[model samples]
Target: MQIPVNQKFRLLSMLGEHISMCIIGVPLMGLSLLTHGNWGFYFVLVLYLNKDFLNGRSPLKRLLNTQVQQTTDVPANEWQCFLRNTTLIIWPLEVLVVAINGRRRLGDYLANTHVANVSEDIGSWKKELAAYRVTSYTFYTLLATGLYLLLVHTLFDWLGF
Candidate 1:
């Protein structure tokens, strides 16, 4: 089945949210690793899940003014939030399945969910670009710097230089 434009918009919003999470997550992961070592992974996971659970949207999604709600219900509750966030655990596999299936992912199939265009106006390139610029400059810049520092430290430590 052909995906609707709104669904496409939702997919874009989801991608934005994931990117935003990575931007914030990687830096925190770096800090956690530098301080506590392996605990960083757990910290990142908890942070990602909790943020998503607290709001139906993440920082990126919020910037875009998009939300992820259940298709069956008007307003998704805590259980749905938990389930939705938990799905991230298998998100990679889910994406692989969706790619192979040509857009019938587990999340879409199981939840009977479809991402809708919640933004008052859809197809605003200016808005999307502005959001991207803000997210990139603020979050991604920190993530890049942190990763660079971590990489340099690891390399020097490994090389004994």
Candidate 2:
């Protein structure tokens, strides 16, 4: 299939990188359980709250050559990186968003960012990270976490768990 959005992030590439990142959670959860009991779930939760787009490219995404950038022509900021990743808790919806719309994912809209063509760079994330709003970030992060827990509980309920 053609790479969508003029060579932004193809569906398979995006999914592959995310799935690969999830793989790392296995060991994290195992270790966290041993040391932190049920808090292990929190340890593994970072699998969704991605910091890769802020600190550095995941080796996989770099190999795939996908870059996240702001739609407003500014380099992506720290909040965007975190908020964009948090939306992966609803990854199924995001997949549908991309596969049907042939456009940015749901998280991209939440963060006001997009996966840009390979030629585009997000610029110094280190510097961008320095610019953050603590109140808003914490508030939204809690909101995202609450939504995640609600979704999980709803799914388990629907399944009679």
Candidate 3:
């Protein structure tokens, strides 16, 4: 089934979140190597597990004025957050699943939640700005940059350069 345009935005937002994690993670991984400490690993582990709760919003979702909500319209609880985030371990496959399921990835199906672009929830001129498609493209640009960083990290590791 063809995904709705709005759902497309949400899907892109999800992908942006994954990319953002990688962008943030590679640097922290470097720090971990430098210090010979697992601090970065633990930090990212917490973030990976509780992304939806980081300051009451997932970073990328907040940027897009979107949030994950249960089908019943309640805020997703911690358990739901953990369940959905498990799929993030295979983020690329998660994107494909979201595309095929029209925005509901396997974890979303299990968690019984959906990502919503709730501009009205922001309550400011920021809501007006989010209405523009440029904002989404900007997010996509950030995602591309994050992917580039991840690729470079992988190449350097593989080449031992």
Candidate 4:
């Protein structure tokens, strides 16, 4: 089935993903600070790589009832996942491609991946609520924020600014 990429669905997915990241990131920052920065980069890297861009159903996609799928009706594999995520890393280029092609970009074309709306109430509310609980987010945010501050401070101090 061809996936329809509705603008509203895309926007909702982005918002949900951002909120989820913030929920996880804050405590990650704090813990990184406590550990002297070693875990910070690792945390960020793991989160980015392991985040479900195709079938894992990222928080945003879950909220929007959307999912990324292969054009062929087959589930996405690891390489497809990596390529699809490249859009996040090189977003400007991806955007340029999408704009030039009228919304079809390299990642979509090459990976045979497209975003489609799934059935809206697929147990998503319970998952999101669990994710939203303050306790679940606190540790991650603290770790991420603390490490970010530490890095900023170190950079300024080194530059004598």
Best by TM-score: 3
Against the unseen true structure, what C-alpha lDDT does each candidate score? 0.52, 0.62, 0.64, 0.58
Ranking by lDDT: 3, 2, 4, 1
Better of 1 and 2 by lDDT: 2
Estimate, for each residue in 72-95, the C-alpha lDDT of model 3 and write its tens digit.
655565556666776665778878
What C-alpha lDDT does candidate 2 achieve relative to the native structure? 0.62
Write one digit per residue (lDDT tens) for candidate 2, span 62-97. Answer: 665556667764446555767777776678888888
**lDDT tens digits, residues 35-66, model 1?**
96755555565555445332344456556655
Displacement of the residue 83 alpha carbon in candidate 1, Å: 1.1
Off by over 4 Å in 3: 1-5, 54-56, 122-161
Candidate numbers sorted by TM-score from highest down: 3, 2, 4, 1
User: Which parts of model 2 have CA positions greater than 4 angstroms off?
Assistant: 1-9, 120-161
- Using lDDT, give the best candidate's number: 3
Among all windows of 10 consecutive residues in model 1, the one with the lowest summed lDDT is 73-82
Per-candidate total of colliding backbone pairs: 0, 0, 0, 21
Candidate 4's TM-score: 0.57
TM-score of each model, in listed order: 0.55, 0.63, 0.66, 0.57
- In candidate 1, position 82 carries an lDDT of 39
Of models 2 and 4, which has the larger TM-score? 2
lDDT of 1 at 55: 30
